[model samples]
Target: MAMQGLLPFLAMVIVQLGYTGMNTTSKLAMDYSNMKPLVLVAYRQIFATFVMIPFAYFLERKTRPKITMSVLFQIFLCSVTGITGNQVLFFVGLQKSSLTIATALTNILPAVTFLLAVISRQESVGIKRITGQAKVIGTLLCVGGAMFLTFYNGPIINIGESKIHWKYASNSGDHSSHHQSNSVLGSLIVIASTISWAVWYIIQAKVSDQFPAPYTSTLLMCFMGSIQCAVIGVCVNHHKSDWSLNSPIRLVASLYAGIVCTALAVFLTSWTIQRKGALYVSIFSPLLLILVAIVGWAILHEKIYVGTIVGSVLIVMGLYAVLWGKDKETKMKTEGISVVMPLEMVEGSKDLELQLPKDSGSNKELIANVEENGTIKSNEDEEKNLGLS
Candidate 1:
């Protein structure tokens, strides 16, 4: 039972690690190999489809639900928001910004999703409740953190130098203004991706309700996303030669992203959601930020700023608050249901007993009849004793 409970956590941890690896490889492909974001997205989806279709086919053959038109429509919508839009924006943003910033910005996802849920009337802001208040405050903190992270770049914290110095430094140095503008743009784009992802969650919930087959849904999303991205890629990049996987880094990035990040990550996430829930999965996102920060510092030799650290702290705190609130709210609701159900059952039993017909007319009349019978027996006993004497 303990291990069963821990399985979801372990799965999510693995997923986050996979995501970290994807970020590293993707950054290398885009920055060093000069792979276009659209082309990367296209390749990612194609690879994911190829890898995931087999699992969806063989594993879910017996139990897979029939995909109706409505299900397909939902899947298409999911593909648009979750796959094509989310990944396209994310890759573009990643190219523009540092890995740490990209990862940190994603911590706002839970807050955004919560706000969306409230707006859509799927969730409530029980302001009178502490949990609800926590959620509201947490959302604000996350938003504030994101804004702070975008605009401010305080003094850089100089960590000890990384031993792995594998970089061709640009000769054209010190373009501070250019980098700043790019960072702002990238942050905004990444934030948009988070919103798209949150929207996907909402739509995917509906899909899960209708379809319930994670692997099949993922395969469909990947397939559709590949087609969508391919069209976009072709129009944007005129150079046919650019699409060639001549570079090892590009090949590795596409393969890793498609197989591990898209197919495996999605499956693991869906499985965790089945065992735990969406909120539970979302809470684990902060782990990615931590992983990215460490990896960026050590491997990429990225500099961390004071503002970045502070903003990241705020985002992490906010993410936890939102998750805690949601978890608390769910538990309270479950407890309330358990409490109300038994009370309702007891009240129903009492009402049933009250409505039952009685054998006796009344308690007072029954007692009086018993007393008169006892008096008659006593008189008979007295007469019998006198005759014997």
Candidate 2:
């Protein structure tokens, strides 16, 4: 039980590490190139598709998606939200605001996901359950923490420069180009990106459900993303005479974002979520703010103001609250339930077998309810067999 519980948390940690590295690297890319946000995002997706295509083929060629016209459309829709909108909005927001704040706001994914799930009738809010209450309260706390991190700022404790220094901040300071106090527009854009991301997760859940193949779904999404981003990149480069390897930083950023953040982190997540659950994979995002803060102060010479500290605490507490609620909910539903990792979705699980607890009378009734509803409505009961390993 102990090891089972730890698995999901561990997955989030791994994902966060890669994500923090990507954030730092992307910032560096902006420093090195005069490339626009669209251009960077376009190239990033192209590389991401290139990287994932061959891997998906080699790893999953036997069960790979058949590439039907309908599946192709799904891939296109996925590319729009998951790849194109998410990266474009995010980099643009980062361009206007601070990465720490961007990370803070983005950590609200679980809450946003929960909210949207409830609205879409994909999940129910068990008001009487302590776990449910905890989840709701935790989500609110996370949001509050994010707001605090962004809006409150008194003292700017100077954290020294990166190994690679940038005169950009100084030049911008002289020009007064960076002040957005929870600036409504910037916040909205980030929120939009978050919504787009939530959409990605929900859709991924469906696609994964249909194909029961995480790698295949990812491959399709990336393949379409490559085409979409390439078109945009060509458009962005139309004005330029020399598009061949202009900026090493852009190339580096695109690779790291594509291969490391998108490809590797994604596979880790699919595996972890299979081992644990989506909620588990999601909660670790808040922690990345701390990682990014450390990186920013150490490498980028960013200021660590009091507000960032306060916000971090709030976010942490709220995240735990949500997790507490989810834990209770899972415990109640655990009898006869098991966390089944679809073998095709994740590797290293083909030989693993779950030992589900014997079903109580209530559990039997619950199963009956699920079957009755299964034929009627499809929703977020991802499986009765989803929990700690």
Candidate 3:
């Protein structure tokens, strides 16, 4: 039981680590090898599609539902927004921005998704409830933090020098107006990517309901994204040299992003979501910010600023506030179900007792034995375990 509970936590941690590596390596590929974001995105899509094919084919073969035109269309939309739109904008933004900023900006995804859900009428704010208040406050805090992080640098935090230095580390001393403008633009674009990702989550939730086959749906999304990205990549990057993966770092980056970040991460995320709800999965996102901050400093030798620290704290606090509210709501609903189930059972037992022959020795003994054995009390015990009294 303990292991079962721990597995989801472990899986999510691995997923975050995988994404951190993708960020670091993808940034390295673009900066050092001059790989165009579009081309890299296209390659990553292709690799992910191939990697997911076998899993979708073998694992979901029996359970996979027939793909309707509606489902196919939704998957295409998911491909466009989730993969192509999100990845392209993010990579381009990362090219112009620091790795830490790139990861930090993504913490707003849950807030974005929540806003979208409320707008779409898929979720309710329930402002009268404390849970709803938390959600609202959390969303506001996330937006405020994102804005602050984008606009303010607020002096660098002197955390001493990093012992480990990356060979591909670019000079971080450039504080020119041009560089600052680019960083602002990049941050805005990255925020746009988060919005796109949030849209994907909303659409993907509907897709999951209709399809119910995660691996197969992911495979189809990747396949569609690959084709869409390839056409865009080809048109944008016309030079034959731009398409080449001669550089080992570029090749590794693309492959890692595709296989680990897309394919494996999706698998692990799906598994973790199955075990512990989407809230639980999303709660791990802030950990990515922490990991990226460490990696950006220790490996890439990126400097941390006061704005980064303050903004990150606000974002993380808001994220937890939102998650805690959602979790509390879920527990309330579960407790309601548990409470009603036992009451209904007790009522049904009473009905059974009234219907039975009063003189029937066997039936009387059976009921007495059950009461003595405390079978119905087990339900109460469960409620106790769930903290519902």
Candidate 4:
């Protein structure tokens, strides 16, 4: 039982680790091997489609629902937001910003997701309640942290150079106007990617409600994304050389991102979301920040600034605060339902008893009973209106 309980958590950890590897390897490919971001994203989708489709076919063949045009369109939208926009922006951002910075920025996902959910009425927030207040404050803190990290480098805290420094890392201190402009643009692009990702979550929630086949949905999204990205890549860069996979690093980055990050990570996350919820999976995002920071420091010799550290701390704290609030709210609702259920059952029993000839004694008593039942119904209605049902 304990092992079963731990399995999901372990799976999530592995998923984050896979993403961490993707970030590092992708940075290596782009920074050192000069791989174009769009081309890399195009390759990722193509390769991910290849890796996912077979598994989706074999595993979900019997259980998969017939794909309707509506479902297909939803999948296409998901591909646009989640894969094409998200991956392209993220890769471009990663190429411009350091891995640690990109990873840290991803911690804003839960906050962004919460805001989107509330806006869509998929989630409710009661500003009058402590839980809602916490969530609001946490979201603000998370956004503030992201802004701090992006805008303020502060004084760099030297944490002793890596034993084996990457070639690109040795000259990472270049502060040319072009580099600075690229960095700022990349940060904004990455922030936009988070919005796209949040939109994907909302779309995915709707898609899952209709479709419910995680593997098949993932495969279809990858297939659609591959085609779209390929078109975008071709249009953006007509040079055949930009799409070359001759370099080992380029091949490795593409394959790793496709197989590990997209295929495996998506499957694992979907499974975890089924077992737990989206919030549970999202809470683990901060783990990637730590993993990437350490890996970047040691492997890529990325500098760790005080501002980055402070911003990371704030983001992680705010992330937990929001999660804690959400959990508490869920628990309270569950308890409310549990408490109301017994009263409902008792009232139901009373009504059944009142139907007997002997108990049907007084019209006055019946009117009182009707009023009490109306009160209960009104309470239930209020709960539903509050989105706590």
Better of 2 and 3 by lDDT: 3
lDDT by candidate, in order shown: 0.67, 0.57, 0.68, 0.66
lDDT of 4 by residue, 1-389 (tens): 89878988998888778777877778888877678898998898788778777777897799788899999999889889888887788878877887787777766766887888788876666677787788789889899988888888788897787787655544433322235556667777788887887677667666755775666777788788889989988999779888999888889999987776655655565465446544566567677788888888787767788888988888888877777676565455222111111101100000110000110111112111111123222322222221100
- lDDT for model 3 comes to 0.68
Candidate 2: regions farther than 4 A off: 1-15, 65-67, 158-184, 233-237, 241-244, 266-283, 334-389
Compared with the true structure, model 2 gives a TM-score of 0.75
Q: Give residue 365's lDDT in candidate 2 (0 to 100).
A: 29
Candidate 2 minimal-lDDT segment of 10 residues: 348-357
Stretches of candidate 3 above 4 Å error? 1-8, 170-180, 274-277, 334-389
Q: Using lDDT, give the best candidate's number.
A: 3
Compose the digit string of candidate 2's lDDT tens values, residues 68-133: 676667656767877777767777666556666667677666666667767776566666657568
Residue-wise lDDT of candidate 1 within 60-121, one digit each (tens)? 79988888999999989988988788778988888788788988887787688777877886
TM-score of 4: 0.80
User: Where's the lowest-lDDT run of ten residues in candidate 4?
Assistant: 346-355
**TM-score of each candidate structure, all chains considered together:** 0.79, 0.75, 0.81, 0.80
Q: Cα RMSD to native, each candidate? A: 20.6, 7.3, 12.8, 12.6
- State candidate 3's TM-score: 0.81
Candidate 1 ranges with C-alpha deviation above 4 Å: 1-12, 167-180, 263-283, 334-389
